[model samples]
Target: MSAVGLTYLTLILIAYGVSSCSSKEKTQRSLKIAGLSLWRLLPLLAAVFGLVGLFQVFLPPELIEKTLGESSGVASLLLGGGMGAVAIGPPAAAFPLAGTLLSAGAWPPAIAAFIVSWVSVGVVTLPFEAGVFGMRYALVRNGIAFGAALLIGLLMGLVL
Candidate 1:
């Protein structure tokens, strides 16, 4: 296992131990909830991976480099951020796609923007968000996320 995986496992075990000691019933309930959530997520995970595989197979590396390469600069970041904002699926799914893009010669800053906006701004969920929170609030929040995504990409470009 990777160091990060081992660390996560150790932390999880420690938390489970403490929780079980404090209240076995509650620990069991928590575990059941987690299992159910994982079960529900399995189909989505499978679909996302399948799509990613297809993307890798069909999308040319040269095309990716041409559109999102380091030379594309600010335009690449903007394009990546826009695509991410409209992307559907969990943040977990985006990570693999971002990794694929990175390995295929997409600019690091573009990938960074993609990840940031994919996790933060959700155009697909905007209506629901607006319904729960006021439309104005949702718009403002998304706007902020979009701007922050671009800013983060810019900083990443400078640093990396």
Candidate 2:
């Protein structure tokens, strides 16, 4: 396993040990709940992997590079955010897709914007957000998130 993966596993083990020591029954219940959650998430994970596989096969590297590569410049950052804002699915699935884009020669700035917007902008949830927190609040929050995503992308570009 990768170092990060190993580290996470070790931390989880330590936490579980502590929990079990404090209350075996509660720890067991927690484990059961975790297992059930994982079971429910399995389908979404499988579908996301399938989507990633399809993207790898169907999206040509040249096309990706031409559209979102270095030559695309600052414009690509906006494009990336726009794409991400409209993209469906959980943020967990977007990571692999972002990796694929990077591998395909997409600009780091664009990928960074894509990730940030995917996690924060939430175009798909706009209606629900508006319903729960008023239209003005939703729009303002999304607008701020989109702007922040671009700023983050610019920073990433400079750093990377």
Candidate 3:
């Protein structure tokens, strides 16, 4: 397992042990709460993944690489960020697509920009964000995320 997963497991074990030591009732309560919460969120998580799978159909991997690879200069990086902003899907789909683009001769900075923008500033989810957090806050957050992605991409491209 990943270090993060191991760490989380360890923490959970420790917590369970402590609760069990205190009293069996606490342990049972904790497990019940966890199970109930997971059950409650399962449907929402499934729906989100379903939406992500549907969204991935819009962007073809070959086209992404071709467009990003056509120019290695700053234009490509900017375009990568733009494309990422428009493209919306889950992290599981984005990473593989970014890897494919990288292997297909897309520039590192452009790939970085795409990955960062895809995670951060999501135009496709903007309406939901605006509704949840107010339009002004969502706009400002997305604007910052877009600029940060470009800067991060530029640095990664130049430095690495």
Tens-digit per-residue lDDT, 52-141, candidate 1 = 898799999999998999888888899999999999777888988888889989999899999999989999999999999989999999
- The sequence of per-residue lDDT tens digits that candidate 3 reaches over residues 2-77 is 9999999999999899989999997999899989977876776676556545546655656656667645477888
Off by over 4 Å in 1: 1-3
By the lDDT metric, which is better: model 1 or model 3? 1
lDDT of 3 at 58: 58
Per lDDT, the best of the predicted structures is: 1
TM-score of every model versus the real structure: 0.89, 0.90, 0.60
Model 1 pairs whose backbones collide = none
Question: What root-mean-square deviation over C-alphas does model 3 reach?
Answer: 5.5
Q: Rate the local accuracy (lDDT) of all candidates.
A: 0.92, 0.91, 0.81
